[model samples]
Target chain A: MALDMKLFKDVKTIAHAGMDGLIFYFSGEPVQANQRVQQYMLSINHAKPDWLKTLIPSYDSLLVCFDCFKVDAHFVYQYLAAHELTHAVSIDGSHHQIPVWYDSPQANDFEQIKNQTGLDKSEVIKLHTSYSLQVFAVGFAPGFAYMGELPEELVCPRLATPRKKVPQGAVAIAEKQAAIYPFSSPGGWNLLGLCPWYYELTDPGDLPEFSVGDSVSFYAINEKQFTEMANDR
Target chain B: MTDKLPIGFVIEDPGLCAIIVDNGRDSGLDRGFSEGGPLDETAYFWSNWLCGNAEGEPAIECIGSIAFTVKARAAIAVTGPDVTLTRNGNACPSWQTLNVEPGDKVTAKSLSPTAKVYLAMSGKWLLNEVMGSAGTMMREGTGGLDGKGKPLDSGDCIPIRIGDADKKEVPNWLQPDYHSNEPLDVVPGYQFEHFYPLARRRFFSADYTVTSDINRMGYRLNGPAVTSDVQNMRSEGINMGAIQFPQDGQPIIMLRDRQTLGGYPKIGCVAPYDIPRLVQQQVDGVVQFNECAASDARTKWLLAKSKRVRYLTEK
Candidate 1:
């Protein structure tokens, strides 16, 4: 895992997230860009930059919060250019297979999504399960992992008017991204189905299930399996 | 029943958005938990101070018209906007510590011209943390005593550690001036240059009104609809006080419970020190933004934090 510190040399854009925070923008697809951000963070972690506070990696950006009292933004930029610290730690590569209960009654907007995409219920679910999509980013709510690049066939606009409450574990899609609702919240994404027993992954020996680089694939399951898995959970 | 028996306050009424909150300090964002803390830091700290509780201790933040019946004597501090606080039909002064006797019903109504009020008890409200925080994040359905994101309802008894009879007051020098018309300090954001020069100038000079749709997550500022030339920016990591520009061009100040990432163009972030004032601003209240250098903002922020620490530790 070799990383070139020079890859960050262009540094074309830096946005102030807050007085103490700065967002360094990158140009690439979600998977590559997010991995680069993680690598960048790992490099910084190894360097142990004194001014660093927190590192938040998003789709195409790496947000850095610093101790404003100790060092300003100018110093960060200067330090990065002056120092030659480029080391990459091996990123865990694993795809979490999640069983989804598609086209269930709780999936309120499946019919609407089908009509919008001109795809039947089974076709839509097949298209969704076909791709091994990466966990691009997770935000909007806790454990809400935004997986990406839904097959063009599955690409559809979000609900014109969002639902008041999209239930927890809801598998949803809008534009190019799909996600599972960690908790019930007001949302606009087209509800596909619920992930059976998907939650705060208790798996040990590694990070949580939805780290930025980890991939995900959904498998269609019947309502009976959904109920059984949920009960087991 | 004896006076020595430890008794708690019974929630006779859990008025608008009344819920238990603490410092809610968190480092669990990697695990998908946002730091959910008080909306108004000045009020939260002051309430804790006057009630003899350390910073970040648990307390009740009442939005409007909260009533509680005390089962035992307790020292309470009602802080925040100029809300009307009453105990047993008698008017009481706020921004300082007050006493609650057994069977006494304490109530707090609106600030009318104000925003929220903090009812801090001398005893610490005890609740099991769901994800390193005690603040009730209703949207996420996690946190608080119930662990179900349920709002405080009538007949709920807030659990707290019983305290001694001695009560403390916030020194006059330490008392904060919650009301001020000074310009809010906003550090320029990354997309600041995306705005037209004229629009940027107007954003700094124009008066923005605080909209009624304010909450712990964010505040909608109603003023000039300043648009950015950049149309489709990718979502990035968002922090507290990031000012976002939507298609409507109106600015929204993101706060404590704000989403971790957002796609909107940001004009700038309102300075952290000024956020307490910004969040407590009443609906339609006029506010003006003043842009400052990031270095200056940090210096001021450190000074403010140090001042609070000095006061707390000195006496």
Candidate 2:
């Protein structure tokens, strides 16, 4: 079945302008915005129509990189436009609960959050652990996903000086965004907790664990579980 | 297994920083893998051309100088910057193929003016392709011979697959004039309109000096602050040679090793053909940016590519 052609105007406009790539800006009520874009991309991917090459959706934007050699930008642009016009409703109910170790000392920004929120360590953990964050985008580092919309009280700015080395599996918050560092590297985000789950670099042939539209809810895990998972790998 | 040759390089003395590289792995950036390639691309292409190697074959990107003793006779080419090459104490021409006898010593000198150099050999180097690329991404611990990005060290032996004795010479027309330093061409970006008109005017007109803070990631420039009136915006996918103006107002030209995305307001991207000049510039060397039509840039790119293709096939 052909995707609605009108949805692709933006794609055409961008391609005609000679842009190698284009970022689509999506806006919906905050409550359903994340699910809307996610479902849109998934449906496009699952349908696997011959014309579409790649359809990537983030929290508020969808990046579509087309095969210029096979299909012109206009074709891809029309596909997106038709798809968006036909599927306007939110696609809800695909959620994942990710286990995080908030109490671990390796959680780099624990003390700073306590100091800023005027909440004791326990209160900070409770606030962070309870909230279900929507996966806003997967970027910055490979498999490094940005999950966000933290509880207002737990909202914290990034560290004044970014740590030279933020350990892998670090769960950090910057502004309204909370992210897990899939790999150890330099980061400026304020640390809150550590997730035992490996977000990146799976062995060849292994399925990619996370999708752009998936929701990841963090649950506190004990040190034993963290070690067991680490050893299991 | 017997047919598979071991790719290795024995470093007599590790030059400033020499490492094995190939066409960077397709990171599946569509799924989030940053494209990592050589810092100096023009030289990278020339190096590959010298040895008649196909594009993406593994080569050595030497930062300063690379001295090595070849255990087996091989055909190799050295390109990039302005570096002197010597084989067993006899001076050799840069940008040409040479037949290195077994046990011969190859030494490369530091760039007198440019920043990096490239050395390529015929036949694929016997190295493992990490994430589908041999190029090293040290920051991500991906790519390179071991899949852990590390510069070549003393005593590291790189094995090369031997090719049949099919020799081709590089024509004089195909050789690039390393001395002809040119200004980079840029196409204004989305945020270019946000900069103060004066800042925009100055950007195209003024001269900016490159700083020592240059690397695979980015080149920090020292020049008059190109101020902007726009506030901080969300980070976006940055292209290679993206000229970004941070809060300090000094522009940072992102390079090969640059992050996948950035939030800084970008003025625009430098044309791919112009990147070689930018990459090779010495610290404090003055550079100016000239805006060109996209069609014009594309035509230039095609012309350059055609010339390169002719050079490759002529020999």
Candidate 3:
């Protein structure tokens, strides 16, 4: 059976990702791709099928994981073709205004980013927080959000050699994206400063504060405020 | 309150790596958490089944040599590839339940680094589930004994509900053959057709060796490099057992502990039923890929799952 042309206008391909996974490759810009992802997520979540397990959203695709014992890729494919995703309920996400301690001691790459972007430390921080950024994806590590469309002047390449250990809560940028390291893992992004906020998994219901398509903006904070705020948490 | 007293085993030696694992978490994929669980899931379930515990009960997944001391009478089982089980210096059989007395010493040793061993005890393991799973994600630092994703260490005592478990053994017909050399089945998807026909052909025909660079995250296979024509692709969500061909051509099968997203072009994903065979393969073990239809792959997966459930209920 073929996919419905009317329902799958943005879907470039509805193919088997694996035995238990089906991927929906979307066409168009990142914004449109994410919209398609949100629509599918909403439609699938509304149904709350037992076979459906997880939905992963990326920049240009949506991966749907199902219980292989209950359903096959074909079943999911046909289900997707039948679901009227266009009528999915669209809802607003929470807006997060995070605080960052720029020029902190953890900002080892501050000078490097300044040299690469041809901007001063304060200017770099301004460009980063100038406009609200959208979370394009969340991966690489737990709660490591990939927020995008960084200002052109702030775009910088990843380090040629990644550091062995990047501190947790490190605010960083690379290419056209900015992110925070929720855990102290090896990373290559240019570190601008550290954020007071972080994601920690303590309970089954614990989730990252942000999800894909959520809007986030950062504000500069002094080290004293960063320390006090961190301690308070 | 008296029944709630801690009763279990203490790790005497954690050799190599050992961590507590369960069936794994179904959620947290969107938040960038991989579905961390036992690498060799077939043996993991068997280990639990022999102990009369639910197949998804939290068990200990270990590599290399591990030794533990029981603090209370309990039934335990170990299963893995090329593993030697010993109880108080006397060699014991694996894949069957063994009753141990207090202060009894049990050890499991795997000669190969490529394979892992699983140890499951009767009764429920006392662990706080994270995201509905006790399976440990070391990278994410979630789940496990302390819910910090730390591997089992010497002197670490694991608490459990001590209960009577009858003597049981897995039927011979149900035991998995870890030595099988059959080619793993792959259900091609995501940029599969974009790969040149010759590249695709090479992937199926070529022999890939399981490189030493293997872990819960992924296995880097050394073989013919199959390059894809698709370039400048946006990073997207990666599925478990997804076969990715980076710029260098060698295929990397993303496993349970893989990152939530990746940018490399993928040819397809390895069938879930064949993943155990791939994970159990020793380093330098030759592996080949065979194309399988998605429907056929799904049937195989369902059959395996049903077989396990059938045996679990029947026995």
TM-score of chain A of each: 0.79, 0.66, 0.76
Best by DockQ: 3
TM-score of each: 0.82, 0.80, 0.86
lDDT of 2 by residue, A1-233 (tens): 01223333323213121223344544564435555555566667666666443444545555554444345545656566676433444435368877777667766566777777677767876777788776666666677676777777876655544455887788777666777777777666777667766535443223225655567777778788877876666
**What's the true lDDT of residue A183 in model 3?**
77
Q: Candidate 2 at residue A66, lDDT?
A: 46
lDDT (Cα, 0-100) at B122 in candidate 1 = 81
TM-score of chain B of 1: 0.91
For all candidates, what are the clash counts? 2, 17, 1
Query: Which residue runs of candidate 1 sit more than 4 Å off their true CA positions?
Result: A1-12, A27-29, A43-53, A69-71, A75-92, A97-129, A150-164, A188-208, A219-233, B1-8, B164-179, B205-207, B306-315
- Candidate lDDT (C-alpha), each: 0.75, 0.67, 0.81
Candidate ordering by lDDT (highest first): 3, 1, 2
Candidate 2 deviates by what RMSD? 5.3
* Tens-digit lDDT string for candidate 2 (B1-315): 323555434679867777777767434654556667877677787787667677778788877777988766678888876678999999988777888877888988756534588887776677777667777777777666555788878887776776633455455565455456566788665466678989988999889998877777788898888877655244445566778886678888877766665556677778777777777777788899888654466667677877886765564
Q: Candidate 1 on B30-90: residue-level lDDT in tens?
A: 4456667888877788887787777788778778668999876788888776677889999
Q: Write the per-residue lDDT of candidate 1 for residues A40-126, one digit (tens) a residue.
A: 776887788778866767777777888777887777766665656486535576888888887578875767877878898888888
Which stretches in model 3 have alpha-carbon errors above 4 Å? A1-7, A86-131, A151-166, A173-175, A186-208, A218-233, B1-4, B306-315
Worst 10 residues of 3 chain B by lDDT: B1-10
C-alpha root-mean-square deviation, candidate 3: 3.9
